[model samples]
Target: MKFLFLITFIHILPQCSGNPLSRHHTTSEEIKREIARYSDIAKAIINLAVYGNAQNRSYERLARFVDTIGPRLSGSKNLEMAIKYIFNALQEDGLENVHLEPVKVPHWERGVESAMMLAPRSYNISILGLGSSVATPPEGITAEVLVVTSFDELHKRAQDAKGKIVVYNQPYISYEETVKYRLLGAVEAGKVGAVASLIRSVTSFSINSPHTGLQKYQFDVPKIPTACISVEDAEMMARVASRGTKIVVTLKMGAKTYPDATSFNTVAEIVGSKYPEQVVLVSGHLDSWDVGQGAMDDGGGAFISWEALSLIKELGLRPKRTLRLVLWTAEEQGGVGAQQYYQLHKVNISNYDIVMESDEGTFTPMGLAFTGSDKARAILKEIMQLLQPINVTNIYENGGGTDIDFWVRDGVPGASLYDDISKYFWFHHSQGDTMTVQDPSQMNLCAAVWTVISYVIADMEERLPR
Candidate 1:
């Protein structure tokens, strides 16, 4: 099935005649003509970072910081440390007006958590409470387990759920679909008065560590203790319950919410020489889940954006329009940081030429996805041709990332660097998502592509007519 989809996509590639791969040689006069006519600043930025040694050093430095600092859960002390680390790094990069904009963020702490079966057979289970989950009572909630795979199923049999712990046994097929269960399962289960809810970890791969993410509570529903069990354990429980054997689960969690804390979004810019009033923004969320250092989830994205801007400055390349880098805060809990930024700076959005975000994990560059008018698309296509040498040739529509959607909705053109996502979902919210899991070489390639895109947009004579 995957092969068929690949073949179909390849066949349709010809419909987009501007694809750089359709042409043979990079040095060909025709290719050179395209490069010269279209500003290749973005591509140059990418090339210098990917192929040059300076960018490699930057990656090494940032990776070291991420590993040593560990997980950066939003509103946590580690997140505060990460913010300072990035702010200092940007200051040293010759960026102007490097500062943090204050943002109010929720503080949720994940303390000790454990779950086990005390039923037909005794066995301990691996689990982690989702962010923002209410703690189980001190004695813990021990009740017979009722498992259902979807909300519809739970709704149909909610009457049978009283005085029982509900286990959401759904399997996430993709990131987009799986995320729904991870984010909403608790609330759905809570609505029916389930003593507690255990959701199957939302990852394609099975491992001992349970995945964790944010969950929402309905206004009227009593908040219930919710946690995610490892996929392996979830399957084991499902098998035992299918045999008509009674299954009792004991869940203990120390999760709690404290008073809202103040955090900040770090911002830095390189003022444009000719069109300083016009702005081109590139960003990534600085905050991450309190697991595994968040290296692959977003540390790579934040570092890549910083490195891209630093490269342009080092090369003495001053863009035509101001280039801004935003290291956003509180992206994990909700898009609170991004929303606050838009509200605080809505006036600036009109001058914003384009916005790009790289929240996707660092992997080999595939191409770019954009959301803009036809004229803007045409302009980007012209610039994308220069990136063909680095195997980043694919370009598609729908270019917004989760954090950048605000800008796109406000009419600023948005783009997201595309990467091979075949393995992205496996470790997405799992504890396995550490810096060691990332490919340094591929991350460097991403940095190259992002630098090129930022440079092109910043150097364009106008706003690409979007």
Candidate 2:
């Protein structure tokens, strides 16, 4: 069965001057009325997802996927298993044009690691080594610990940083502001010759949990072992330093980076009945951090994308444009898989109608955050009204996902799910990121949002302005 929008657009098509790809698609006034006509079709799609066969299905599938596959760290055998598992599952679902594209991803292992405070009332400090960080010497580095609040303070105390273990207790301002200390804390400390560095985890809310993520190393600077310490511990050590109490610590890590490993960008699609070459892409990274179940970070996002295809197929609703799902590999390693995908598919960029990603946790539904031209926003704005039944009719501008940032930056219409994120960072990148953080009803609403928006855009007779 065709998307109901095709029937609604039959009379509306007379108002458009040219083909979908032509510059003269629809006049502003004509588009306004034409989009309003889609309300019924939109309601049908939304109803089929929120109240029909797809209810809670995405959440159940996500739980099983993450439970069976655990954390899918890049280049691990576990991630390979996840790719194959989904490759088979997509075929089983009968999605058309299912395939995998090869890409080389970083292979790094976080071996046995720990930290101990030998002075100032001896105790153990929880630590999770940052990605791409080098290991300490076999005996580990034992040095006087230096606690500073920020990079400015470290530079002012450069003399004290030498031959010491620098600990950054920088206050959590925001993830964007605080995360710099995690991503480049070692490089900054190395300038002053610190033997090692420990950054307070970059999170606003924590129960003494340490979050691990990718860190950067400069080529010309000395590389030192770095890890994230619990917020509680970082504060305690800072108070000890304020009292002029001697703080000493020993750090040991067996972190190693092997040569790049071959991985894949898992792919599946529902081919268009009309213009198959024109595409509306939906995606989330299949790869995740090694610590948690990855259910919240992207397991939810990836499954919701699959659910988009699943729901559409279940309803027997085929769009006019192909809907493609690319489960990215090594996205945690700085969008490596997505960047490669962009390169391989950019020649067909002209055919890309829009791209969507849901890296943010699938929580309560709000609306989409779009990045595109004013005309595109107008089209999206009208389409968002269809979600009134679910109360997710808002549309934020200039927001897109990390994995799809490249496509948006190059002038393609891009969107990221914008929802309630109050507790999102609480579990991000920690062992706290598990299926418990997910709610089935919330995922159903999220899947409905992704499906409604993707399918409506794909089936619309007029193309969105780029």
Pick by lDDT: which candidate is best? 2
| TM-score of each candidate structure, all chains considered together | 0.91, 0.95
In model 2, the runs with Cα more than 4 Å from the true position are: 1-20, 23-25
Candidate 1, residue 409: the lDDT equals 86
lDDT string for model 2 (69-112, tens) is 99999999999999999999999999998999999999999899
Which 10 successive residues of model 1 have the least lDDT summed? Answer: 1-10
lDDT scores in order: 0.79, 0.89
lDDT of 1 by residue, 1-466 (tens): 0111111111111213432222332222333354465445655566677776565755586678787788888779998998888888788877988999999999999898888789877889888789899998888889999888888999898987877889888877776787788788878878887888888988878767788888888788888898888888888778887888889988899998998899999999999888787788888888888877788778888888887788888778888888999988998887788889988888866678888888887788887888876656655666676677786756687899878898898778898878887887677777788877787778788887788777877775445444
Instruction: For residue 190, give model 2's deviation from the true position in Å.
Output: 0.7
True-structure lDDT of candidate 1: 0.79
lDDT of 2: 0.89
